[model samples]
Target: MTSASRTFIDHAVSKVPAVTLGFWIIKVACTTLGETGGDWVTMSLNLGYLVGSLIFLAGFVVLVSAQIRARNFYPWLYWATIVATTTLGTTLADFFDRSLGVGYPGGVSIILLLLITSLGVWYRAEGTVSIESVASARVEWFYWTTILFSQTLGTALGDWVAGEDRGGLGLGYEMGAVIFGAALVVVGLLWLWPRVSRTALFWFAFVLTRPLGATLGDLLDKPVAQGGLEFSRLYASVLLLIFIVGCIAVLPQRAARRASAA
Candidate 1:
């Protein structure tokens, strides 16, 4: 290989954690925290969705910049970025769905389109959308942008599924959780099947986890009459944050190793 090729390869280091059971556990917790934390700011604190979005968006920008600038995978930083995206996603989705009068379905459609566009452009530019391919600043930007959209889309989806009279399935939060959870199991099964692209499966599962977390969050915070436990959003967020910290402390997370030169 040429000198330039060697340099490019040498700079490549997986900036994401290995896909493992613990990774999924922490991911679900982060998404759940996103929901409760967003709600705590927007509802419990009376900041409103627009204000909440602005706050979390600022955090998202800062953390994502730090994440891209880091030399290698840092579990805390990576997950902190994820939490920012999820919380921002919650508030941004609500802003579009309710504040903008687009409703949940419209918000879902719009956010999903954005997500597809991000992934499409990323693939066209990088030739792959796999997290394993996240080895550079440019790819990292694309990955986080795609994640923001997915998180927004997930919030809209979870709310729609839980809605009682707003053209929703009226499944309630618990049922919504069940459905998303079952879908994730199917995605896991597909991962074991031959010829299924791991990249595709990873993204699919990633998207599903967001809504699952959203619904579960709602289940924890919504009123009893609304089929929820009526827990305090702040308390729920703190509990989830603790779980995430514990998982990060105990879980094995390492950057993907560089490929050997031919």
Candidate 2:
């Protein structure tokens, strides 16, 4: 197909979901479940972070392959891939931070570098990093790679802020949640300013949601003395999964509109 025809085809059939309030809601739930579920597999099941990461990494690869192979947007499939990234993020962050003896600062710095590198390369290759340009499988690979890095960064940030016992700053989960939540509100305000970059804001919001969910998940599953409610990680994960599935079933699922291929 000609470039114009290819761009037109891409515009009509984006394989990702449109950004909406519902999208944010589901995203938060997915991230939270990722935290709890990852912890369950790593801690509760007695698997090391390395093992957990490898397992989730395998799942992520399989899911991404399926997502790319599909011809159209599939709500369940897309979200499943997202969850894979988040879970992989959780375990990978832990492995990097603890097992490798890199504290939060080191973990964040490493992951942030990776995230920036991914975005830089993607932009150089695709001309735009906006979700609007995520139409083809090549772009989808870039999108998911960027997402994995972002999720890992969020995992480190949240754990650093809340899980002080885990070599973090010990600010407590509530405070961590408050901090990330407030940042998100600020991003929302910027979104309303009319001069802010929508693509920048979207990524800000997307990365912020992961930490918010991380803190929330920690609060749900940590011991009361540690400032959490002491819930079972498995149970919390199950509950979050149910909520995510319900929202996906109830919410409007639409593909994102496309931008001209550069």
Q: Looking at model 1, which ten-residue stretch has the lowest summed lDDT? A: 253-262
Over 147-236, each residue of candidate 1 has an lDDT whose tens digit, in order, gives 999898888899989887556779899999999999999999999898998889988888999999999999999999999999999999
Candidate that scores best on lDDT: 2
RMSD of 2: 1.9
lDDT of 2 by residue, 170-236 (tens): 8999999999999999999898898888988998898999999999999999999999999999999
Clash count, predicted structure 2: 0
lDDT of 1: 0.89
Cα RMSDs, all models: 1.8, 1.9
Candidate 2 error regions (>4 Å):
1-4, 7-13, 165-167, 260-262
Off by over 4 Å in 1: 1-12, 257-262
| Model 1, residue pairs in steric clash | none
- Clashes per prediction? 0, 0
Quote the positional error of residue 163 for candidate 2 in Å. 2.5
